[model samples]
Target chain A: MKASDEERRNDAVIIRTEGLTKHYVLGAETVRAVRQIDLTIERGEFVAIMGPSGSGKSTFMNMIGCLDTPTAGKYWLNGQLVSDLSDDQLARVRNREIGFVFQTFNLLPRATALHNVELPLIYAGVGSKERRRRAEEKLELVGLADRMDHKPPEMSGGQRQRVAVARALVNEPALLLADEPTGNLDSVTSEEIMAQMETLNENGQTIVLVTHEHDIAAHARRQVHLKDGLVEQDFLNEPVETSA
Target chain B: MLLFEIVMVAMGAVRANVLRSVLTTLGIVIGIAAVITMVALGEGAQQRVQEEINRMGTTILTIRPGQQMWGGVSRGDAQLSVEDAIALRAGSDGLLKVSPEQQSRMQVTYGRYNSNTQIMGVWPEYFEMYDHQLEAGRFFDQGEVQGRRRVAVLGYNVPETLGGTPPELLVGSTVQIRGIIFEVVGILEEKGDAAWIRPDDQIFIPQSTAQYRVMGGRDRLNSIYASTETPEELDQAFAAIDGIMRREHRIRVGEDADFNIRNSADLLETRNEANQTFALLLAGIAAISLIVGGIGIMNIMLVSVTERTREIGVRKALGATKRAIMTQFLVEALFLCTLGGLLGVAAGYGASELVTRMAEWDTSVAPEAVFTAIGFSAAVGLFFGLWPARRAAMLDPIDALRYE
Candidate 1:
């Protein structure tokens, strides 16, 4: 194949979901948390999935992050189908391909920032010297290189969020999945974190961010808004430069 | 990145909860120490009993008559005669001493002092046979028996009844047995009683003198004391004497015997059996504590799993495999157990020493007990550790991540 054709062929289509659904039985009631949905994402695409509370945005993010299996659907990542993967296989895929940023910045509380960032590499069987080098580089990238030895509890909310971002990017995963990444931060810290995420995306990283705010979703080129477990709209945002 | 990361995490977890880990380990330590100390007690008791039995000496046998039958129809009386004693000594290959004894209670008198005591008629060799030694004066001699002399040897206690005078001073002094004046020849040393009579409180006279003057020349004798050259020939001596007595009395094989023979070997065997029983009991009690310690490990591990639920979720969400989670918990459990086990071994040694000092008893703590105690504690850890590790591994990452 030609190099451009091969680049397109191997362009890291990270998430492809068809008829994805999640149903849970509580007592006698069967609740469908996420209805049938089809979605596709390509290499280096910065996309935002927006939904209000109980709109199935979190459930969809979990499936896309390989933390949960779809009840009935075909989900593929990097040309490999993931819908039928076992728990162990899913864990391997999650470690190698997807990095997650939770709303609460889920870094281990008692662990140092370096240890937290080294976690993915440790799980991926990376050697210690290389794990340390990569972890340090990622922390430097997130502008927290001097705080590598500090624990999560020792850092501020903004600093902790940045450490979590460094951890997410350490493995050089194909996609970064952030679920309400700035929900717990103050407005200024939230803006700072959003700017960091923007810088990461500009450096040729794919990002699928889940958020409820329109302003947060507007930071990305493409936005998909969900209402009541169904996609309400899918459109590109107007260019920020033209609007200014 | 590999299994070592989980091990390091476990180490970090233990380090963070140092007090809790130490307390948990203490439970196992106590369990192991209890088991070890109890076993040591049993072993010490066994050794003490055996030593006590051995201190009584060997090669000494006691014979008593068989029970009387209805209408006296048994093989006459079981009375051991002087004739039988003499025949036993002459026929036995390694016989060192043989004496027939007759006992009777009577008033013994010296001047104004009078005391009722058991009188024993023993041959000259009886002094060395039962390890009896002279404090003052000498035991009766062969010439006294040949002449049928009325000479008595006072045991150490009998001198107290005679106003505490030396036996030599009392030697030519007259002591009347049943109103007959008998010259005191020797005094025995203060050897305490066996199972029955006190040797120091008894009075000894020549067999011939007691036979003729004391017992009125009756043909029947009460019992016999026989001593072999050494312990090795004791059984042979017993068999030889039994054979001579039976033949002299014209008793055939399979006929009812006239006497019963008892030896120190029987007492020794009984002491050994009791020791074995004690050891078994101690081991059983120790095992109970070990089981209890194991349950404690299980309880603590369960609590740890609950406490670390969020950590597990975060790791799982970060792509940690279930095997990694399981190994983390298992290593933690093992570490706790091994630490407790080592401390327990030290505790056992100290406990044994304390017991030995406080009670004045012998307590020997063997190396095997230390190793076994530690191994048992670790096994307990492994056995109880599995459930909590599995519980942590089986956690659903989605539910765990959302758990408060």
Candidate 2:
């Protein structure tokens, strides 16, 4: 039987990079932020990019998240080339294909949790009712059903992070990108967020997490470590049994 | 749906800084209020002038004596006499109704009440020329004028000045003017003040009675009034009066006539033009204030954009387009300006009402003026909001996100 379009796209690589590079000119010298990295991640895979502060992981993540254009080379998200897209087109790609969860929980501080979760759908041109419904579902999935009306300032740090997670997932994007998601959380809350992400990966959600902490990187099924603007290690980990 | 979300976001941002927003709009409020009040006052003055024009007949002309020049040497003021008026009336060929007038302020007494009042001496045709209607009794006839009878016609407010007696009751009563007793033959209905003429407060008497008895035989008329049946006939009447006056005074056609003829309509039109120029100048000053107000809005909007830099970065990272960001800021500015406009209109209307009540001046707040004020304020919003909105839209998301 001929594969359906959705099935074909699901089988295709969710993210592919060919010699991706980014450089910044600091007066008299050029700084190579990300240098000649070729990478690929298939649908439903959980991966973590681990690096020290100056190891170029943030720059690589920004390029992969469609937040920054590369200085050289190609990037394909969901089988479509996106590295050369214009600023506005990159915004559209971010809205439709990639979901972002930030360490600071980047939810609009003044907006209620539900409103914050509905933002991506708003940019996706979804109807108000459908946006609310999908946002509610995602918030409920993140155990924030009772806190949907609370603003970021009114919520606990972990709860705000969960709200950010819900916001990131509400658009049903092909890739979920989390950059230092548990950076500001307590140990227990960080574990809680990581376990939630692990559950999401088991449910066939493709995830890419960026972090400097080894414990946070351990939650992903595979890990890639970077140093000096180049990948130094790529390895898979055995699934750790949950306490529950 | 996106548009609705954008509008909501803008509303939320404004609400978040309610005090700042209100304070920022104060300039626009004062500017629009000034514009509205100034326009209303100007319009009221124009309406008053129009009413004055209608009150003083547009088809009537006043003949006043100008300086008489002899062989290009300056002479003192010339005189217009009753005989010159008679000559114009006779030579008009049924095209003009002429009246010679003499007036003075004199003490008038009725019983125990006495007041200083204007006494007017005019021909019997004067009432018809001014279209004055009688409230009671009949006007003095030509026979009365010819026989020099001491008959008077009371003006609308003359009864009030003389002990507040009713017009109907005072018509047949005798009033002493300058120590001469005259019977009131008629009372005129109210005629409002028109420019220099206050006909409602003056009492009219026959020109012969005034010349022989009241004015002590002074034949020099103050001025002559000439009227045509239609405004279209004023030019012909003017030429005929000029010819007759020249012939009576023994002046040739090529010489400058001593008498100057003035059309009341033209004089009022000149006054109206001056009023309009003054109104425009005031409005121009008010418009400058509006522009100053627009600059104030621009200054505040730039501050807001700078303060909300991180918020803008978050929105952009969450997939907000440049157009969306621009629209958000623009809508906030537009909303602020429109709110100020509405408040200003209300304040201006209240101020105009206060003026009418306290100063007794006519003021009308036209709906078009209100709408134009609001529309102009909105335009100010768009014009001044552009730079700040553009600055917000062009921000790089990575740099903005990292903004402290």
Candidate 3:
């Protein structure tokens, strides 16, 4: 059953991490990529993680995305103790619960937009017929329906990013993870991508974006800023409106 | 991914660089072709030897004069004679037929063509032993042999040497051997070559006629050919002849026989064994090429895995398991090998045919060789494809994704 307006305030939290820590060994030197931190992200919330280089934002996003495990802490994704899962089990969790969107729009160079969008569902064991239908819907949702046959190299940067977005949404995952989504785009294309993000957020799609630019981070309703591998400031902002 | 999808992806990777894929599989193709062609040649030679044995009669045995050594081999060998054949015929219960044969080399002229060739003289039973076919006219009968008539049966090639005339036309021609004229009474059909012996090259005459007329009434013979009614009776025939010869010649026990016996069936077995060994040697040498082809696949696959590192990472990020990644690469290698194998089989078939056409070498391609070659090629693919697949599967997605 859909949650009514009264139960919206008690919406289930989709991502929760307690004392998550990531440490690296570089030839007798210890680098803490992520320090002990507790973070909770509720469903349908549009959130962004802001940090400079070496601030551990990417590392933190990798943990939340189930791409890497927390070294000595607990991670509960959709209420599962994912920190203790094996690499294969973590892969299952990543496939079923997360859809990653990289900054460079990491579409397979040789595959068409349609095939690129079908990749996540392919890993999920979805049959080709249904996979095609769902991928086409996601491409239409991201306004790249006409570019289904185009390869990444054939598309412009904005179109490529949209195809990536369609691929991310095709699986209907629990969370959308975008790392520096607009770092490689010009201002006009960035605004266009941010507007698409806003539309997705308005449709109650949960988002966790990682970016260094404040203007890009401003697109998310909530921002978690990091410094020295720890959360420095967490606040809410009025969402930037890009009319065009 | 589904099996077809994995195949499609692998095929796509191969198709992306068609030239490299073809060149990489060239090693496998050459390897398989070599194996098949060699086996075909060996098989062809074996069949030819077997046919020669069959044609000569498996139950047939030839007895040749054996040498006797005395005081460091100063003594001469014991020679076979008509009396020995008569003794063998009378004493050996297992003997079906015994024939005494004599041979002499002399120049023969029919009209103006004169050539020196071996002329064989034998009993009427020699025709039965060799299963001779008359292309024209008739064989000189037993009456002619007893009467010592000057009659000869021309072999298939004798007419060619005499006048390049057809065998049928030479049935009534007169051939003079060593200044004595003999009438050609029959013409034997062409038997071609068997192993190294050319049966078509010699003419035949009655033993009595040859001894009394040509050799001045000599009674000695060059060999004695004996045969058994059935193949199972050959050993008994051999033993009976040995016993009779020993008693007739007054040889002591444990002494070497005065003649050597050669069974056609045993020769056939030896030749077949030699052919088998030759086939094995050829296959062993050709297998090296398959291994070399496998190495080529491994090398190219390793390069492919490296080149597709980023794509592999993306697939892993999109939730592909290590098994899926591994299977994708393995299927790719399998494709390369099986493709090579098929091409090799075709090439092998063509090569064998080419050999037959160009050199007139008898070549037979056994179906088993084709199947074995294809099967081995697939195995090579699986074996060589393993390392690169495991390497791709074991790549850390996080590191791979970050790789340029």
Top candidate (lDDT): 2
For model 1, residues B300-333, the per-residue Cα lDDT tens digits are 8999999888888888988889988898999899
The segments of candidate 2 whose C-alpha lies over 4 angstroms from its true place after superposition are A1-11, A238-244, B63-96, B109-114, B142-149, B160-176, B179-183, B208-213, B216-220, B228-285
- Recovered fraction of real interface contacts per model: 0.78, 0.67, 0.61
Q: Could you tell me the lDDT of residue B395 within candidate 3?
A: 92
Tens-place lDDT per residue, model 3, A1-244, is 3652223234487887779999999999999999997888898989999989999998999899888988888888776779999878888888888888888888999999999999989888899999999999999998888999999999999999999899888888889999988878999999999889888988988999999998888888999999989999999987456557
Per-residue CA lDDT of model 3 for B239-286, tens digit only, reads: 887887888777767877677888876656665775677667768767
Ranking by DockQ: 2, 1, 3
Ten-residue region with minimum lDDT total, candidate 2 chain B: B270-279
Query: For residues A17-123, could you state the per-residue lDDT of candidate 2 as single tens digits?
Result: 87899999999999999999988898999999999999999999999999899999888899888999999999889988888988888878889999999998888
lDDT of 3 at B324: 89
- State every prediction's TM-score relative to the real structure: 0.74, 0.88, 0.88
Error of 2 at B308 (Å): 2.0
Give DockQ for candidates 1 onward, in order: 0.60, 0.63, 0.58
lDDT of each: 0.82, 0.88, 0.87
Model 3: lDDT of residue B269: 67
lDDT agreement of model 1 with the native? 0.82
If you assessed candidate 2 against the hidden native complex, which CAPRI class would it receive? Answer: medium
Which of 2 and 3 is the better model by DockQ?
2
